[model samples]
Target: MQKRPNKISRSRRKNSAQTIFTRFMLIVAFFILWIGGIGVRLVHLQINQHEWLAEQAQDQRRNQVKSKQLRGTIYDRTERALAMSVQAKSLFADPAEIEDVEGTAKKVAAVLKLKPSDVFNQLTKAKVENKRFVYLARKLDEDAAEKINDALKNTDLRKFDEPRFAGLHWKEEQKRSYPQKTLAAQVVGFSNAEDVGSAGIEQSQEGLLHGAVIKKWQDRDRLGRVYDETELEEDERELPKDVVLTISNSIQYKTEQALEAGVKASNAKSGMAIVLDPKTGEILAMANYPTFDPNRFNEVAPESLTNRAVQSMYSPGSVFKLITYAAALQENMIKPDGEIDCRKGFIEVGGHRFNDPHATKVMSYGDAFAVSSNYAAIKTALGLGKDRFYNYALEFGFGSPTGIELPAEARGQIRPPGTWFGDSLASMSIGYELNVTALQAASAYA
Candidate 1:
């Protein structure tokens, strides 16, 4: 039995040695394949996705922001500031860094006077989505922003060692402000919350007034605190050009007061008045009734923001009679002291009768003009004929824009002599068929 056992033991030992060797070889092959797969994955990550991964990582700790340069200041002829850009703070938050979303929302709502529930919901959504930037309020007033900053300082988690609102920050921004408020509001126009001009001169001169856009990159800590800021290299920055208007602040104020009073007393819907320097053709004052404050332009009707002095077109009425009388006198068609019969207050033309509010049997040309007698004007214009009258009107700068540096200036409606109807001369003489703007009227009188 001992001799037989010896032989079996030797065979079993040999079989065991072969089984261990096979297992070692299989393990070595499996490991080699595993290492090759890992190497391939590393190559793909380093080569293919390097830029995207780097950007992803950088975006977490850095932000690129656009900052608007200060808009040019608008001044009156005397160099008094009308519209200007003021430095202000715009509040924002990094939602991912906001540890207490509800608490932060409440604090922001209280400071900004916003709806708490709305702010809370927005903050919650942003946090859940891991948003990095969210604007809470823009262009806050100095007093309000100072109060918010004070509150933040007092409740700072790092400074006060208390659980406080985090991820709250502010950026510098330019806010368009009209220190004169309603003064020259229509002429100066207004810029909206986004610093875009909406009306009047502000819109017409936007290209010159708007400053260059500045771009910057800012580095932030894990808590979203901006620690460093660097301006990115760009093309030359153009400083905004200041606009110097010929408007007189004193005259504009007085004119507005007078116009407002006149409109209210006359029970009129709206009114406009323009005063010009006769020698220089410079506009001294332009005033509109029911004018709005440019600061609160968004709260008013768009129609109310219209600069009626240049934008509105209307019949010149008796005002146009000066042109007819001048044309008649200039052509020697009628003497300065000549008398014309009113036909007892009415006259007929093309089956239409034109009446005179203040009429007499016979009156001097000067008397006719003084009383604004429609019959006398029409009679004088008829003597000048159609061609002469139209030419005179064109010479007076009617039927065309005055070329003032303002937006939406109406050229007015002037039909050609060929388009005139049978009674067109009579109608035009009394200023019924012709249209003109207030600025045109002022220029003509000048």
Candidate 2:
């Protein structure tokens, strides 16, 4: 009751109250701004970039699995598989994840019949280079890979609790198998470890055989458990079409056998033969000497792997006389029964002298053909002259490839009349000077 407060004391008291209120407001404002900043960040991440964040998480959770990307089955006209793709296993390892590198190399080498030193060197190199994928073995048989997996499991090399093994891993791959072995080796050809067509039909029909790789989306957990699988778009998914050839199995086998015998009996360096349907002109069988097995193509020499029927060019010999006879007969230059002076199996043309196997003073045109008379053929070609001779050969598909469905086909060489030497016509009449393939001659005869 007695002490009335001084102005200075009241002022100090009000100032202190004001200071406390200001500090309290500042703290509340600071907290509000901080919380609002956090909320804005959450909105941006959740709404604006939701798909991007989801993809990032998915990338971490799922593993991209690449398949063997095998080619389609190659079947004969009868649906017998000549070249086929089969399921097999390939072994690989992550250098970073591999523990006991030397041990892994030795153990795997023993099972795969690979040199331990080679395996060890490769693994060590991969580790030093920080490589994630290294193939230990490729295109192994299913039973063979299982043996390796068994070995790894028994030694506790594969850690079951881990996301992936810290050791060897197995991948399913497609391997090319030739069921008929060397039966149609050159015809079917072969593919490499990567399933690439190397020769023959395999190389020619690579587009249809080697289908596109399908990248499928699979949601897998850390333990490799499948959560969900997304269907690939129809456009993205490619199923290789099976290739059916016009080759017949029975005819092919017989042709090969006969050709083999003929080659051996003749004691020739090499030979090639083709069997075709005269009406259809479809290749029933194509055989090559010293043929190789498509299954073991690597072990054979390159020459054996050649498809000689359409690739090798040689003189037609007496076979080409058919063209000369046809041209002469069609032009009515000589009748089948007309007599011609063979000059005792020798004839002179353009300062060149030619001899025949059958020496006859005078013989009918048909008799001259039956005896394969070189003199008769030369005279016949000269009678047709350079222009008619060249035209007849051209009409028979000479000087060009037959355009048969095969790889590395060869087009025979033939000079036009403008380029022909004086003796060129004579030589060509007997299937010389010009080049031709076994298939070409066969087709002409057909």
Supply the TM-score for candidate 2: 0.86
Query: 148-214, model 2: which lDDT tens digit per residue?
Result: 6666564333354321336567767888899999997888899888888989889998888886765
Candidate 2 least-lDDT 10 residues: 156-165
Q: What is the TM-score of each candidate against the true structure?
A: 0.81, 0.86
Candidate 1, which ten residues in sequence have the lowest lDDT sum?
155-164
Best model per lDDT: 1
Clashing pairs in 2: none
> What lDDT does model 2 reach?
0.84
Per residue, candidate 1 scores C-alpha lDDT tens digits across 284-307 of: 999998899998887988778889
CA shift of 149, model 2, Å:
1.1
